[model samples]
Target: MIIGIDLGTTNSLVSVWRDGQVELIPNALGDMLTPSVVGLDADGAVLVGLAARERLITHPQLTAAVFKRYMGSDRKTLLGSQAFRPEELSALVLKSLKADAERYLGEPVEEAVITVPAYFSDAQRKATKIAGQLAGLKVERLVNEPTAAALAYGLHQSEPESRFLVFDLGGGTFDISILELFEGVMEVRASAGDNFLGGEDFSEALIDGFIAAVGKQHGLTDKTADPAVYQNLRKQAEQAKRALTGAPTATMTVLHAGEPLSWTLSDGDFLKLCEPLLKRLREPIEKALRDSRLKAIDLDQVVLAGGATRKPLVRKLVAKLFGRMPAMNLNPDEVVARGAAVMAGLKARDVALSEVVMTDVCPYSLGIEVSEQLGPGRFQPGFYLPIIERNSVVPISREQIVSTIVDNQPALHVSIFQGESRLVKDNIFLGELILPVPPRPAGQISVAVRFTYDVNGLLEAEMTVAETGEKHRLLIEDNPGVLSPEQIEERLAALAKLKIHPRELLPNATLLARADRLYQQLLGEQRQWLAQETARFQAVLESQDEALILPARTELKQFLDEIEGDGWL
Candidate 1:
């Protein structure tokens, strides 16, 4: 049976189409929404959901939460002396959800339709798929969160034609999707969002404010340096954030140094602290509206989704921005999961979803990096040449031709990037490939590069040499953060070995090692230099352009040698 999974940042849910409607599957605790937290018990047994969430306060060092923010990055979170990638943590959540579905359905389910933020990049989308695979489920489709919400709403709408905006504010990410419904089709007009912004930021804002207001008085400088204290503060702030949804004021307190540091935050004070986050929210909304070529008045309704939208302040912001109270007929937290279940039903050819047709748009522009001719013999690199613009309907193929920049160039190297940036350096480097071309005078040889994007967010590039009649296809593999098929198998084996059964083995010392431990310890100039160099090196590695990465790696290695070799240490 095929099921729907909303593998969210703060919580996750599973649902399925049953008896002509979507039915949510409850976990072992009889809760539909499971906290997306994972950890290991003192006895080396794995714990997830509410059990793991509660441990965040008592055993902060053994638990990990909010790993979804690093979905497509190489960053690792340490959980009980073992380091895990974001996807690995996500897989544990998905695995638990899958078990819930199986127990509720009384059958084995192997296929799923997972929902992701519409603005999730290709790498992030791929990571979601990998997570599903790790959980023993074949991800049949990946529907965008907003698009899924629209699908669920579209199926129940009485009107045949209507346009609406989906305002999704979750725990660790935010997305704005504009969609239109006509006849029997639901179309996504545009999508925009900040991957790093969400309800967690508000909690963090409060934490920062509390520290600034009372840290020095209690001799609690850099409270976050203590994981237990930080976790306590975070939990308090989260509870306060939730309480403020219905109340005008909430008290936030954390126990530190055997004393209670308490602060009563009024709605006005909370708003003042989160003013920057609120302002940041507007940019994505404006961009989505502009990209759709529609004004706020053009929207028939603004639908809210995600748990964070339940906040009164956020709701007020939405109402103010659209000049209308947003619709919340469907529970904000459950709507996306319902929509994903509808997609699953559609995949299964269920009669309930037979009349609906959904279409999504590419959230970001996909293109290649090129060198622009500056003079007779000079050419400047790092310019982005777009092949497919953002918001274009997906399952699209777009091509653009370009000539060699230099005379007698043996081969043309094509670097693929994804973003709206005019400069390639500022964009996300997807992958690169070198196409062999006959050496000729500048602009004498041309190659047509065609980029094909599908509904799954998989991008394939085909470059054809005009003169040689040769074609090379780049499948965008071997990325540093994206695990390959072989790597996936290896990961699967490793996970099986660490299956969280009763064990007495000692923790591996190296599992707790961090690449930036020294950098975090350094002060001032040296710390700044390390950060800058590390970022520069990481960018080069992400580009996957060996020509640039090799030299940058060498330079960074030398710098690290100086820092680690006796100069600063």
Candidate 2:
């Protein structure tokens, strides 16, 4: 069966369409939301989700989080002695989600429709598909995150024809999409975003503010950087961010040289610290509206999505810009996954959704590099010729023809790129191809370069030499960021060998790891109380009696909830 996945920067979730409704699958911890974290145990066993997220604080060196930001790059993060690519880390999370879907559905799941940020480049989208492959899943489609959000909101509303804007600000990326729904058709008018801006930047701003205020007084300079301390502060910053969503104040504390340093942050202080990030949100919103050829006042509804939009500051900024209070009827965090489930249903040809049609737009321009001839023997290189412009409808094919710049050019060099820059140097190089042509005079041999972009965000370029009718294709499969078949096989075997923490033991393991993490952060009485309760829970697990273990686990969870402020960890 095909399932839907939201492989987010901070969290991931699995859902499926069943019994005429979208059903979210719970992880081993029995929670719909799973932290996108991975780590290794003392015995070298693999740990995922909540347990690994907790371990991030206690064992900072052995855990990895926020790797999604490096999805299309060749960056590697190390856990203990092992170094892993971003795709590898993401695969572990996907594998865990696949297992959860299997358990919930009582069947093996082999295919999925995964959602990604609308602004993700072609390389990043390819990496996401590769991650699904590494997890033994056939990625049927890669749905844009904002498009998915719009789809969910579109179906949820009763209006037959309406225009809406989806403002999606997640943990590590931001996207804005303008859409229109009419006669069972949901059409994306435009998409714009900043892949680098998100809620994480806000947390980082708070961290920087704290360091500037008093960190130097404690001899904590750039030379004295500590991973554990950074992780602790990041956690506190995230909590403070969430607390300030509704409350006017929150406390952020961290340890330095075995001493606790504290700061009480107010809403005004946070706004001042994060003013730059708030300003960044405006550019994309205005761009999306402009590209759609519609003004903010023309929109029927403004929808708020992604977990970051829950912040009061972000909501206020959106409302003031759009002149309307954004729609929040659906859960922001789960809306994308719900839309993905709907897409999966559409793929399955569900009768209830047979009439529902959806469309998406390419968020960036795809083109090829060319040289302009200023005069004879005075040609200038590095000019970019766009084949498909940004915001163009997907599942489209566009072509452009060019001739060799120099006489007797044995082969035509094709360098495919993606961007809106006027110079090839400023654009992103996707891949290249070389097609042989007979030796001929300049501007005599013409080659047609065709770029076909599908709904899955895959780009295929085919170049045909007019003189000899020779054709060459570039599928971007040979990119350095993508792994080869041999490498995938090797990595698959290695992942199979690692002992994943058993599903049956995840509850106890997660609880113990959380308690251990909290223990490291607390002091005096609170630490002692946590230790006593953790010991009790451990004893119950060791007893192996279902009757006592169930109740004991529940009680310990309640205790932790009261102390830790409801899953903020």
Candidate number with greatest TM-score: 2
Q: Which pairs clash inside model 2?
A: none
- lDDT string for model 1 (245-357, tens) is 77989887776776778888899989999899999999999999999999999999999999989888899999999999999889988999999999999999998778888
lDDT of 2 at 331: 94
Per-prediction TM-score, please?
0.87, 0.98
**Reference-based lDDT, residue 408, model 2:** 98
Q: Which digits, one per residue and each the tens of the lDDT, describe model 2 over residues 1-569? A: 88999999999989998877899999998899999999998888889999998887789899999999999888989999998889999999999999999999999999999999999988799889989999999999999999988988888889899999999999899999999999999999999999999888998998887888767788666522788788888888899998898799988888788888888989999999989999999999888887899999899999887899989999999889988899999999999999999999988889888889999999989999898989868899899999999999988999999999788999988998989899999988999998889999988999999999999988999999988888888897766687777888898888888889888888888888888888988899999999999998888888899899989989998998898867663
- The most accurate candidate by lDDT is 2
Off by over 4 Å in 2: none
> Local distance difference test, per candidate?
0.84, 0.90
Question: Scored by Cα lDDT, where does model 2 land?
Answer: 0.90
Q: How many clashes in each candidate?
A: 0, 0
Candidate 2: minimum summed lDDT over ten consecutive residues — where? 216-225
Error of 2 at 525 (Å): 2.9
